[model samples]
Target: MNLLKRFAVPVACAITALAMTACSSSKDERRTPTPLTQFKPAINVERIWKADVGKAGRYLFSPIAVGDAVFAAGAGGTVAKIDGKTGKVVWRTRLHTDLTAGVGSDGTLTAVGATRGGVYVLDSNGKLLWKSNVAGEVVSPPLIGNGLVVVRTIDGQISAFGAETGELKWVYHNRAEPLNLRVSAGMTFAADAAVLAGFPGGGLAAINLKTGDDYWQAPVSFPKGVTEMERINDVTGAPALVGAETCAVTFQGRVGCFDANTGRPIWQKPFSSTSGVAQDNSTVVAPDDWSVITAFGADDGRQLWRNDKLKNRSLSVPLLFGPSVVLGDYQGYVHFLSRDDGSFVARVKTDGSAITAAPVLAGDTLVVQTSGGDLFGFRPR
Candidate 1:
């Protein structure tokens, strides 16, 4: 699911009506995006590399970093392998099809999903291996592991294919809700053998990587509100895994941690987020629906600190890079906040377009893909 595209229409309408409130004598004022406040830069960030692929407007394909090459897929089905150090294009290929989500890989093989219910696979050299048709439109990237390519679709269907021959291994189906968020559910590997997934109805399940049999299925968040929209509890983003603790956040629900192997609750915390959770050694950080970044203790889910400086800015997911937590906003601004106290450390401007995808990290360099098709790499100076 691409939440930025899904929310852009209403956000634009609010922006257009802002001037009337600003000039009115009445006590009616609309809350717009908070203006970026000026501050001394605490850390020096430099743009070390940049590139342009096809337009990424309104699409949600995130770049994947593998080894020394970073594989990026654009919204228009252009895939490129760029060198991590020099930002040189090693190989580029066009699928001749519109892509919905993709750029997932297992080093030697890569896969992307099409808008027309198909998935395209490519080898390391950018050669097309095989294309397989599935039952539903895939909004999330495929998870490649254990010689299988596993993909989850918008219709709550999960399928596995043989990585080498594109053979269909097995498929699992779950009952979907009538009203759910228009975002995607990312899949992760538990112990490198079990396929872990968070569903649109706030259900978490684990399946066998090879057999596709059900290992375990449990509800992470239950619908609680009275209205249907308020009760929408989709797990939109990817779940974070640290050691054996797997943490996930729900859109209108709670954030909790579960044991990866047994699905037992370690700690359950009341928090709402469309973005997923990111963790370091001691803290787990997440952005709530109002763009407030909050930090909690990883061990006990204790509240550490909260930063509301970027409220209403429509923030992307927080990324923990080195000593700072980085986030991108709707106005194409990259912000750096201290991991210790949730204080602003630095900020930089991009192409002035919304950053629809999460910021990706490759070694010491930070990479961000914007909706305006600008791919940038930054490093702390």
Candidate 2:
């Protein structure tokens, strides 16, 4: 796909991040570090392919790759699937009410939580599998394991259902003070069992995928404070397992990694400590809270290097694009920096809108969604 470069393009997009901000954890202990103040220097980026598909999933809630195609949802319950390489919509459907981008077993199947408190499914070719009303407005994406389906509502309720029959399994209540956790659910690693669904008040519980039984339970995080923001945390995004360490982000602006077996804190940093970290074969790389990309020893959370060139409003979970660590800023720009020294290498001037969502790395195409509903997929020029 040949493309044109649109630098400083005057696009009417809201970088305010109100939509993205709402998806963030309610607790922000310290101000987020600005990327400009870091010690790194300028990097280079080139434009590849830019098109207006008019669908953006928003920050932590967005467009994702499910096998060969990427799925994005819009305001009017509009869901579209784009060819991973051609930026073409292979399938588009309007589900009446607004729906969230789905996540499930493989990229082949999609399960989305709708604002109207419904759970919907789609097959690999973008065909509707089923739609069932669970009980509450589905906020968190559904979890699949052990032949059971788990989902949570915006108000912090967890419901387990039979994945095959869509039959109600069991329901659990998570009564957390609603200070403003834009999201309401989370999950952690369970040995050979199912994914543990994390709730509020530091409630850590796991539902057996086979029988929906409460396997093991623990707290997501221990909060200590007198203020409203201090006491609340909304878990967003799927938890990343760093080897034996299980990592998760809370709405309170805290990143914690715990022992997958013991539920102990392996390492913890604030949202400002290192908002997002991406793991590879060898490195535990994280975006510094202030203005740097730091690689830590995954074995013990030891800091290796601080590449200051990759800082921004909200540090996204960096995607390894080619030999570069790809991170998008709040200004809607895609940056490809050297993974070793954090040196700026290539930068592609995107729509200049805040790219709150993580970039999708397909077989070859680089897919990202901006705040203004523009789906941009790029390739090396």
Candidate 3:
């Protein structure tokens, strides 16, 4: 949603042996994934339900739709559950700390970071199942995988906790450098059999969700005196598991492809975006400081097309689905483009709000929440 990466946290080391890396775009140089030769409904923006879940005091959280419920955490530690179809609040729970959670079909686990306290497990009906504290400040969302709840904190502490009994399985704390990367935002993006997390200290890291082990990590280092911080802003963009791997964008504005297992950089190139990268099945897209929309092959780091047509306007990350990827601009116009070649599709005006977070898909519905908190939904017209 924002323009950047998180490199401001305090850590004891620059690189640690506690997480893995997922490299994206390493096998090819300039080829898109083979054309899918398939089609689905054209993207029609629709609004299913809208609620003013008042922004959580925490700067990094967003509304998450899991199963049939829409879960949101408020700034004041209020948890609200809304019906996915009705937009009606089903129940609300209050916690001592604001939450970022990893949701699943069974249930969810919420984090309060290391300093604030521990992680909590919540039932779909708004019941608190259990809680276990960790070590630092949590800025990344909790990740649920392999019957374990994985939490990452600002102090470079990663822990694996029992999903049901709130038991501590393992805790791996990495010593970071004096200038550690701050995790103002990140998500547990699942790839292969692992859940990927960590966009810090020059690059990305992947953690084994089951055993609490580090696989591989790629340092996203930059040039001298060109602080990855001053120029880069937030690694707020959660990963999109595109193609055979999971992907993320750094604040420096490049589409990064990781191995999804070892956190190795398969390939990376400067993506010109004031924001970050967005992906459909075939292409990864973004808008630059010049406010241009560009497309790259999802399988390789080759430039496929650049649509300067979206010139000089602020835009959100591209939302990719079947044959179309849509983007909403600061002007409030949502644009639909052909997934095949970035050809001109239709552009529709939204509620005229600045688009921030990447658009999300709910069932057959395209859900876009504006910076002003306006939620718009669409289906094929």
Candidate 4:
């Protein structure tokens, strides 16, 4: 089957919530998210600045922060570089093509992926450098590192391009599953040597930056049920690496920590989540499908605590900052939870749109871009 035909039917149903199951169920049985309660704010959450990029459309495109700047793109084809401290627009340009994911940069070079299977690279000043074609929908921001721009597409293909010349370097495809989430597990650099990515089949592979060769391919989770939906053990979120241990979660499988260099598993725990994992120095935090936030020991994968207050809320990837872990929900509210006990510490409202993308913590300030294209910078007072 062609890529579009293979995904068209399932994607039509699943694209509503990006990772939601489109199974037939009664209206009453549909899990309505919990009503948020009024609580005294424990910490002062202040919005430093706000700006609009454009409409975000269907995909959860996010801004990438590098050093003193934040690069963001909207589905309406607008891309801008914002001043990190002031939220001022440094430079803005229109791609004239619908963007699926973007704003990956290495401070000097910036890149964004189009829904129609291409990548556009820009300089720090927002000038178009080069545009290159790729294989599938670029649902995640390309990873810019080590003179190579790496992109993971929706059809289980990872391709690299020359950062300077826009030449095709290499491509790697993971085992494609018919039933997988429409979202992409954003890629990252591991130990500054390999590009790490998670794919639809609960697989994690590291490709060497220099040679584009596979360093290691490890199974973070596995399929284990009767129906395809039940067996959908896709690694939907980006992997979290802390020191030598790397952790990733799957849709219907396990969350495991592995050795960064070799593909040896250190510890494995059964968990299900579409949102990616987050880590600080002590704990690895993840939100399961029902929006339950759980914290695990960084070294052992031992369950430390679980917070079910945000059940069925469709939380974003957890952000570890200060003494609390922060999460955004379907109703455009950002909730801060105590890292020590999973208690709610602070809550703030965005534009009342779903904050589907994870909050980026740059330095001590927290940056959140809502699905509605409202970019905000928050700091605790």
Candidate 5:
């Protein structure tokens, strides 16, 4: 049997289409990326340091920041903890197998998933604690908290293992869809005891982090199109949580915020994104599939402003910094747009490779990892 027919084409194809807009033979002009316009720099961005991790081979790997250290992994099995301010390697560990997902830590224990269906947990000093097997392919970074290492597999299984012993605690199965995007949709810790995650078919659920039981499940979007390709509506990233509200975005679906406790929709808008949403107390920002960044009112889901200058640039999830909406593009350029007006304020280029993961704010520095495995820390002046 043809594997593509059985598993459906991964959303990576769509990402490739968006990234390779310059090479597309299609006559549609919208497929072309928007040219960067000249803008006066409003803020000075200075590179603090750069470090090389191993490359991410056809997979998305993100670095997690805990306190002053950033834990990062690469597909070639290198996991390292770097100082957030100095960019110096605190400790580096190399696993025996390739890593498919990784770099979750609580400052004491670090967890990552291997390509061969297992989770590896390490102590704060980079010593390998234990490894445990899971049911399916792990692509989302494991959540290490509450004395448990929670992992979500591509087959819709969320398993919690003992953080120290590596013993399985419980497993929660999300309703599987006929076709789902094989992308890195991660889980977030919710309310100290629950794990907030998005599932295939646009579901947002809060699972008990210790027992793997469901607290609440809400729908972010419903599949509507006729074709299987058109009907693929998977929640594409880690849901953003603030106070009692949690927000998520789905592919070919909607962007909505829901009450974290009751799973009731606060407000939803017709939007499609291959990434997640970032929000502050007042504004929620996300990039649509074409890389048009839009900001919405966090309280009522009203459209505030939009900047489409980076369309078809394959933007990552927006990082809401102090006064700017920060994001990276396919060309490895990190952009800072004014949060109030969506205007470009500053831009900096990397090693000319795609930055698939969101730019993380480590301490006061902005950290970004490119697909080519270069991690750079920047500070605003």
Candidate 6:
């Protein structure tokens, strides 16, 4: 599947080929990916280590870093823990069932979801603790914190299970949209005791991590078009949580930030992205649907800079590193751009495969997982 195009279909056809057929029919009208150009290195990027979990067949699997240990899983039901500094495998476990989303850990308990609505929880030493089930297929990594293993299925159902005993705790159902994007929309932990998640139809909800209560709900974007396909405005990725504000972006909608406590709109701008935004204290960076990376002022929502060199390259989510924005592309090339001006600073290559998940910072090292199941740890110097 072309990750650059928006594959909008009904929820009933979530894992079918209807969305793929629709996207392929318009292949001739798609824009070509921009070619890379040579540039002088502004920063030196060092490859710290590399490891392989397994291949991610049709789902996006993101590796999670707890402290100095990194947890990663693949669609072949293999999960492993690696040392962030030495890149040595600590332990590996196989579940026998095919996994759809995974690698969520809190340094003690690790969790992964299977394609058949099965949720597996493991201890730190790679021992299977317990197993549970959900209503729908889990396409996003489960939220592992607050003593709960929260899993969100593709059918708008959020279920929470006990991290230790795998007992059913609570469930929350989000309002479903007629047409939705077949992509992974993830969840994040806010400063408050709540979980911030984006849903179909551009709705953002903050739920209590313990009691499954709604903190607040706000609209990131509204559907506005004549046809169903044109009006598909599902939130694409995980909502980013800063100190007091949380921000999210929609597929065919806008990017906006809201107060983390009250869910009030702080600022918004007209933007469309297939991935989420990464923000620090001063800037919010995101890639548009065409893969043009842009930066916005975190306070007043002002456009700062735009880089069109990666258009249609199927870039992953942008990670705001110390002095650069790190991202991976379709050909397994990691590109480092200056956070101030959006210019290339350094580039590196990995196994030739598409990287769909965002890069995570494990301590000071940036770790990224490719669809071919290779994990690379890079440190910018």
lDDT of 6: 0.83
Per-model TM values vs. the true structure: 0.90, 0.75, 0.71, 0.93, 0.93, 0.93
lDDT of 5: 0.84
Clash counts for the predictions, in order: 2, 13, 51, 0, 0, 0
In model 5, what is the error at residue 311, expressed in angstroms?
Answer: 0.2
- Lowest lDDT block of 10, candidate 5: 2-11
lDDT of 4 at 315: 89
Candidate 2 C-alpha lDDT tens digits along 1-381:
001121111000111223334224355533343444332434434344555545445423556675557777654466667777777777776676676534443455566677667887676666777677866556555765555567777555677766666788777666645453444244433433545555544445544555555655555556667875566554444555544555555544555555554566666655422234565445556564343566665556666667755443565557766678787776776777776766776666577676755677655778887766777877775
lDDT of 5 by residue, 1-381 (tens): 111121111002223324333346266787777778888999999999999889988778889887778999999999999999999999999999999987799899999999768789999899899988887888888888778888988866899888889888999998867777767888877646678899888888988766678988889999998887778788888888777677899988999988777788999999988777897668889998888999999899999999989988888888999999999987899999999899999999999898888888789989999999999999999
What is candidate 1's lDDT per residue for 52-121, written digit by digit as tens? 7777645566777766677788888898887777788888899999988877887789899988688999
Candidate 3 differs from the real structure by a C-alpha RMSD in angstroms, to one decimal, of: 10.3
- In model 5, which residue pairs have backbone atoms overlapping below 3 Å? none
Instruction: Give the per-residue lDDT of model 3 (tens digit) for 290-309.
Output: 55667777678688877666
Q: Quote the positional error of residue 284 for candidate 4 in Å.
A: 0.4
Q: Which regions in candidate 4 have their CA more than 4 angstroms from the true location?
A: 1-30
lDDT of 6 by residue, 1-381 (tens): 111122111004353212422234357445567789999999998998999999999888989888888899999999999888878999999998999998789898999999779999999799999998898889889888778898998866799888889988899889877777667788887632777899888899888777888878899999999987778788878888777777899977899888777778999888888767888878889998778999999898898999999877877888888889988887899999998899999999989998888888778788999999999988878
Residue ranges of candidate 1 with Cα displaced over 4 Å: 1-31
Q: Using lDDT as the measure, what is the rank order of every candidate, best first?
A: 5, 6, 4, 1, 2, 3
Query: Any runs in candidate 6 off by more than 4 Å, and if so which?
Result: 1-11, 15-26
Q: Model 4, 53-106: lDDT tens per residue?
A: 886788887777877688888998889888878889999999888998877888
The model with the greater TM-score, 1 or 4, is 4
Tell me how many residue pairs clash in candidate 3.
Answer: 51
